[model samples]
Target: MSSPIFTTPDEVEAAFYAALAHADLDRMMAIWSEDDEVVCVHPGSIRLIGLVAIRESWRQLFASGARITVSATHPVRWSNLMTAVHTVHQHVHVEGDDRLHPPIIATNVFARGALGWKMVMHHASPAPDMDNLHSNDSPHIIH
Candidate 1:
């Protein structure tokens, strides 16, 4: 199949999840540029910089037996012709019998380069207790 080209931040975000669903490493890397400034951070994991590190990280994850299903919500976006940033919360559900994994919060950044919009950064972390705790009054609270 042809490589992915991100015309918009939303498209890139969608491709990211699609790649995960298929566990297609090449398709996943297509969302990112080969630039040295590219960065990625999986939930509770250290930051990975440059194409080599980022690719390796994803390669490992894809190699793992677990399959991930991600749902994104509340996208806060900012952009110009050359750069775009999206702060989103991802609810990750792992396939198989295990049902105890918690959701993750992620901040994903993209940039326009020679090819197209390529992901520049993805910083994900486990949500704090307060963020996860049930609160009836807050409509923004993730279930």
Candidate 2:
């Protein structure tokens, strides 16, 4: 795989969502680093490690009936020449209704490898309110 010249973190982020929107498993996997150390934690799920597990997990998710849309906000970024990290809040909206899904906080880590910027870690979890219950925010529509 050739290295992708990612000019901005937003570009990498956009590609990640675009891949999910299309349910293109290969394209989605391409964004990740080819290493066993890579990690992904879906909302309300246990941490998934390595490329194979991550790929299978996404495959299962994409195979589900519902279509998902993700809107991102409040991104915090850290980077060096070889790596970058982005922590963003995702407001997910499932199709068929206007109801809001629980908000997700994700820590996405990327490494500049032979294949350019590849995601190494994606740790996502549901946001807990001050009372310890899930947050009660309205779903945000992506424009």
Candidate 3:
């Protein structure tokens, strides 16, 4: 599939999760920047750098043929003309799993290039139990 011009960071991000829901590796990688420095860190996994490694990792994940759903919540964002950073809570559910998995905290960075916004980095780690607690300073909310 030819890459579509993703106009906004939100649009690219939406596409990112949509791709994950279907395990569409091509569509997933399409949201990433073509830079060799691109990064991805899955929950409990070592950091992966570059498109080649990233692609292979996703390929292996998809190879499992598991139906996975990812929902992004509690997003905090910062952006300029060329770069955007977003932190969100990723709520994932896998088909046939009875236990609830703790939400994963993810920071995704995007860069605006000639092809529009493309993700350059994605780092996700399992959120601690304390993070799931509601606080006076902030309420845990999902949009």
Instruction: Assess every candidate by TM-score.
Output: 0.85, 0.83, 0.89
Task: Give lDDT tens digits, candidate 1, residues 1-143.
Answer: 76666788888889988999888889998888778888888887888889899889888988997788889887888899888888877888888756765557888888887777888898999876664555546565468
- Model 2: how far is 44 from its true place, Å? 1.2
RMSD to native, candidate 3:
5.1
Ranking of models by lDDT: 3, 1, 2
74 in model 2: Cα distance from truth in Å? 0.5
Each prediction's whole-model lDDT (CA): 0.83, 0.81, 0.93
| Model 2: per-residue Cα lDDT over 42-131, one tens digit each | 887998999999999999999986677888899999999888899989988778869767688988888876556778888888875645
* C-alpha RMSD values across all candidates: 4.8, 6.7, 5.1
Local distance difference test, candidate 3: 0.93
Better of 1 and 2 by TM-score: 1
Candidate 1 lowest-lDDT run of ten: 132-141
Compose the digit string of candidate 3's lDDT tens values, residues 1-143.
69989999999899999999999999999999999999999999999999999999999999999889998999999999999999999999998997899899999999999989999999999896784465446656656
**Candidate 2, residue 60: CA error in Å?**
0.3
Shift in Å, residue 65, candidate 1: 1.4
Choose 1 or 3, whichever is better by TM-score: 3
Clashing pairs in 3: none
User: Candidate 2: what lDDT?
Assistant: 0.81
| lDDT (C-alpha) at residue 106 in model 2 | 88
